[model samples]
Target: MRVAFVSMTTTRHRDTEGNRRLERLAHQLADRGHDVTVFCAAWWDDYRDKRTIEGVTYHGVTVSPAPTSFAARLPVLLARYRPDVIHVRPRPPRAVFAASSGGTLARAPLVLEWYGDEELADSRTVRLLLREATAVVTPSEMVRTQVRERDVADERSHEIPDGIDFSLIEDTEPGEEIEVAFAHPLDEAANLDSLLLALAELRGRDWSVTVVGDGPLRPDYERQAADLRIDDRITFAGECSQQERIAIYRGAHTFVQTAYREYFARELLRALAAGCVGIVEYQAESSAHELIENHRRSFRVTDPQELADAIVESGDLERRTIDEDFARFDHRQILEAYLDLYRDVQESHGVL
Candidate 1:
């Protein structure tokens, strides 16, 4: 497949989840013997219009993150490339509009990845883009619903959660016995207090917790833990690598998801993949609960008391080092899903 990816920013410009996603997909497609090209505002230092890095080719549509100029130039370049599929990010809605024109000229179908964290430049433009896009990929049902609410056809929308490195989970041995595991940036939006209070509820019991990640709220969380007198039982390991996190999750019996807002619970996914009994607290602004919807080994709760109750209930569950069920979330499998979507779109558009 000849694929053209449209993203105004790369990890080089802004290391965001949205940017990293398109970047990874482009590279993966290229490595699979597909002709992949990324049309983005120039991240290259030279005056050249294009550059090849690794197996993927990058074609600069503008010299900077100038939305107007990038949109104006994107269509012609994409048309010239003659892509079979145009994979794009759903933000800066004007750019999606431009990519639509490019997709039209190239006889390609546009697939938009909606992480639900994008900064929609305008409401009208976003609606139009949602209506026109051949496929809108969301990482969670929460996002899929939001897109569909805009009157997009059901078949055109899909829920494809972010993939994880399941190999890491399988390869890394359990670090230590962690009865409870919680991983999230100790930031304002991260509802660490819920987990802390829940742990306080189980203070008299025999259990240990490993809280991964660090942020400005770390000191506050530490102080909160101390105040609750459950500080000794909880360890604030602070921003460990992915391998380290998987090890803890692999050892842990229960993993708590208590963040205020999450488009998708990535840390929870990692824990579940490692066989931790998932316990998610329902938050109005968060889509985290959607992950545990149908799973038998998971619990969806409302408050800290419910969180505590679920933790106690988790003790009865068997501990596992790894869960094979999550193999579908592997990066290789997800890349294949993208290929499948591309093939479907191509066949539908008579571009095969």
Candidate 2:
């Protein structure tokens, strides 16, 4: 199958989880003998218009500040590619309109992917996209529920969770200190202040923390740690490479997340896969708690103190077992599901 993926950006332009996931999926599909082409905006370098990374081809569309110009060019681009199916990640409303129009022009089935809780307003543009889409895919049940409640798509909607590349997992011994790790941009929504306050509750405990990722609020978080008097015990490792992040997860004995909103907590899953005892705070917008399997080794806390307690008591619990059956999140399985969806859409729409 020849698949064309339309998104606003790619990992080369921005190192975001969504972009990374798209890049991984494109490569996986290509490795499985499916031709994959990704159409994205030229966000970074202006010199190159097209490039192939690994096995997947990437075509960069020069975006104008005006939405009208960008939307006008999308159909032309899509027609030039002439792919069998079009997969779109809708964020900006104009992009969705463009992809819908382009899919129609190319006579290809459109697959709209909802990755976050995007509140759909009652508008003609949204209705048109929903009506034209061959299938609506979401990364979690929470997102699918939102789509259904908003009447975005009917029985054509699917819940396909984001997957991890388990081959990246490396076996490593746990560190000496009861190292608790959390990786997120040091922004207000990260709720690092809560995590710091929780750690302060265990002042003299033989444990330390490694906070990965950096952002504009790093200085504020650093000051908060100093004020809590746990600065020495907490290390702000700043933004790390993917390998460094995996290594940190593998070495740590516990992983904790206190983000106020996370559409899908891939970091928590990675940590758990690396054998870390997971402890996630319950946030209405976050689905992090859904990943916890073993109640004894993992926990869902409501407050900072409970998070601290979970970290302390985690020592008594053995490392959570991740059996083959639990490894359904493997990217291979995810790709197969996507392939099946492509076939369904092609067959139903009578697209050869």
Candidate 3:
């Protein structure tokens, strides 16, 4: 299968979770003997042309950095790639226009893989774009419900969970010290204030808290830690490469996810793979709930007291090992699901 990935930007964009996910998908598909090509915006630096990464080809279409929109450029790109199937990742509001434009140009199947509702456009445009999509892929059932309620095509919508690279799980040295880690860009939705308060309550305990990732809210979070008098026990390790982040995951005994809102709690998956006991907030309609509901060894708490309680109860180190339960979201398994979906779509269209 010749698959063309159409996204606003590639992995060059920092703090971009969706771009990294697309890169993983492209690499997985390519490794399985499929011809995968990425159609994306050229980087702002010296690279004004095309390139390749880990066997997947990238067609870098030049667009004005100031005034250009991805929607305006996608039509030209689809004509250039002419792939058997078009996979569109999350984008700005222009994504709806781009999907429609690509659909008209390719005459091939289009799949909208949405991470969250953050990038969605108006209702009319969303319905129009989804109506043209051969399949709509979302990371969780929570997102599927959102699309359905928004009147997107339920018949074409599918749940495809974001994958984790299992390679990062091997040869990891689980640290001897007891430390709880929370890795995410500090944002309002992350609700770090609550986590900080909980951590403050456990200050004198034998546990240390490490906060990873950087964002606009870092200073505020830092101030909160100072006010709580737990600044020394809390380590703010800024943004890191994938390798570094995985190593941090490996070293931690407990992983905390305090997100007030989430599409899918991917970092929690990485924590599970690295053998950390996870503490997450339980919202029935949130992505975190969709993944860890009824799962043993995973803690879901609603309030600050519950989060603190879960963290305290998870001090038993013997039960935190990564077992068969955490093996379900590996990259290979996720890739296989995608391959199955592609084959199913092809067979249904009588193109197989």
Name the top lDDT candidate: 1
Candidate 1, residues 1-352: lDDT per residue as tens digits?
7889999888888887778777888887888898989888888889998899988988888988988998898899889999889989866677889999999998889898888878766767778888778899988888888888877788999887788988888999998988989999889988999999988988889889999999999999999999999999889999999898998999899899999888878889899999999999998878888777878899999999999999999888888888788888998998888888889888888888
lDDT of 1 at 283: 88
Error of 1 at 29 (Å): 1.6
lDDT of 2 by residue, 139-174 (tens): 877777766765765678898878876667544333
lDDT, candidate 3, 1-352, per-residue tens: 8898877666675436667777889988998889998877667566456777788887765543221566677777786676777788756546545755775676566777776744555767666666666787888888888878767766788998988777666656554444788988888677888788888778767678888899999999999899988898888989977767777778888888877777878888888788788788775546876666766667888888888888889886554545557678888899988878877766665566
Angstrom error of the Cα, residue 278, model 1: value is: 0.7
Top TM-score: which candidate number? Answer: 1
Q: Ten consecutive residues with minimal summed lDDT in candidate 1?
A: 117-126
Regions of candidate 3 where Cα sits further than 4 Å from its true position: 13-15, 44-49, 65-82, 90-107, 283-286, 317-319
Model 2: lDDT to the true structure: 0.78
For each candidate, give its TM-score against the true structure.
Answer: 0.96, 0.86, 0.86
Ranking by TM-score: 1, 2, 3
lDDT of each: 0.88, 0.78, 0.75
> Which stretches of model 2 miss by more than 4 angstroms?
8-16, 42-49, 60-66, 117-124, 171-177, 293-296, 320-326
lDDT at position 269, candidate 2: 79
